[model samples]
Target: MKFVGIFIILILVFSCSSEENSLEQYANHPVKFAKQKIDNPDNDFSIFIPKNWEWKAPYKENGNDILGLFANSKSNKNGFKSIILVKKYKSSQNSKDLKSEFEYLSKQIRNHSQIEEIVDFGSTDIFNQESYFFHTKSKSDTNGDSEILNFLINGNIEGIYYNLTLSTPQTTDFNTDMAVLVQSLKTFEILK
Candidate 1:
């Protein structure tokens, strides 16, 4: 009986040590970022991009304005790409508040056919601004074996509605990727 107790204690100690090591790894792995400035006359702001990620500035295409685009160089085992896209829209006088906008967006997402599940949705303060966020799991168009993770944050800044999206394959580590992306989002600053 004493031998069995010792064996059990040893197992518990090793398990706890491994868990602590995993947490330490994440805590010690600091994410590096590069600052990106938007030179648009209408919308003057800057945001941080994860170092080594590809970045494309705001541009017009097919009469549509794209605020910014970013993508990480790493791809999941299934070749699924991780990307961040920013879109800006002019807010009208009758534009809805952040909470109302989140309600509308949540309704639309719930009605989408490709959306497998809405994992989480809520409104929170980000960068001292009221923001709405949605986390969803969706069907993958490219790979039937894999699903897609979709995260979106929307807020109105200085009469402009900004939508930031982070999409990645479910195969990637969600916690790690979210930590980096959220850190990048926290760096957003309005210069106007």
Candidate 2:
């Protein structure tokens, strides 16, 4: 059973290449709805939210820009998500460094969430750019809603930071879209 769970994590990540973005397995994912919204008043930020979710602004004292997303799987009560945010310091230079930072941050976030790191699949985005994928789960913390997180250098040249999480409402709620939220990311465009 333990090994099988690990296998699932591997499949969720590992899209074959670091520079390829494929929705191949995304649809197989039970994500229902998703959206991209401006999380900050300054308009310097945005994030994708999954369906049947609730959004909460981050506290001022938080070290990094943060937002909360709670998912609602109308059918599966165990279908939910939470997103713990950290900063993404990425531009053009040293792309590898940005990827490393994301990976390290994901590790720290997973530990804070009390979840064990199961899979860390390396990935890339639309333009054939290298990125990272991570999945963490806290089965004992929540009954059905397990935390599935993907920390990566975004698919866009904008270098957006993505932190996708999934869990149940009993444990926590992100209050945002789960499926369409990713789609929202695809539609993201950079501004001068």
Candidate 3:
């Protein structure tokens, strides 16, 4: 009986330590803005993630793959919020086909019933690549209001089509998050 109690205590102690280690492995505390580049070994592309941010594993949906980077613990209900989502769009049209490409994207967003407002940010060049940038506010029954900063880049490397987006909740300050997001976007490189 005494041995059983000792064994139970040891198991509890190890379990608590393991949980703490797992949490630390997932999040970086005392957020700081620094430059870090992520190079993909399996693919011919890579990008920089701003300081105070960490990238999560790519998830799949409807036969599509999406990679997300977060500014903080995504599980946190209230925190400095931001996300950079990267995805590939299989298309025969080259990256220079920005106009038609973005038009398709615009059409998709318009289909979302909860989107309340969309603010056009026009076209700009980053990393020598032409991109269309915009902001949208979405109202949902569960999420309330969310401010999304969308970036569509015609990464003219080879025949690959890719787009990167930055989204955050309206509860957070947009100016601060946008600065970090834009800086990271500018550092994107096509390593093909």
Candidate 4:
């Protein structure tokens, strides 16, 4: 009986230690991104949303600048949320070149007062076409100490420029969400 009791205690202690080790490993391991294809209801273009992100129906904008918008369902619409906005421009110029499109996007954001930092994330392929990535922080009035992660990307298709943006507060622990967003952006496709 004494031997059995000692063995059971040992087993319990080892099992608890193993669980702690697993948790440590999980915290140290890099996150893998997830991607899911989403169809565009307004046009032939299709985009990808990260795991757990859902489609948001396009609503009437206060202005004519927005073409579409999407967001992660878990986001708070009233608060700082993770979302993608599709901007449409009517112009005769072809904006398909990824580098130029990125420059244009950078230029547009240069004057925003709320933007705290802008980092050039370099170029990444999306929809088999080159896409430029940028990381930025925007001030959140609600979350005083928290910074917002803004993921911006742009590409031109058929002489039109489309800008997609994703933003969420950093306090939410959005590392995996950001990775998923990047992966989803990589899968973006627009039908010509």
TM-score of each: 0.65, 0.48, 0.65, 0.60
lDDT of 2 by residue, 87-170 (tens): 333432333455655656655665675565454355636313454655445555344445454545453334445344344322
* Model 4 TM-score (2 dp): 0.60
State each candidate's clash count: 0, 27, 1, 0
Q: Which of 2 and 3 is ahead in TM-score?
A: 3
lDDT of 4 at 115: 74
lDDT (Cα, tens digit) per residue for candidate 1, span 153-189: 4443534566676665654365566556666666666
Q: How accurate locally is residue 76 in candidate 2, as Cα lDDT from 0 to 100?
A: 42
Question: What root-mean-square deviation over C-alphas does model 1 reach?
Answer: 5.8
Off by over 4 Å in 2: 1-24, 27-39, 47-52, 58-61, 64-96, 106-113, 126-130, 140-145, 154-181, 184-192
Report every candidate's CA lDDT: 0.56, 0.44, 0.59, 0.54
Give the winner by TM-score: 3 or 4.
3
Candidate 2 — worst ten consecutive residues by lDDT sum?
169-178
Q: Per-residue error at 130 for model 3, in Å?
A: 2.1
16, model 2: CA deviation in Å?
17
Worst 10 residues of 4 by lDDT: 19-28
Can you tell me which runs of candidate 1 are displaced by over 4 Å?
1-43, 59-66, 70-72, 91-94, 143-159
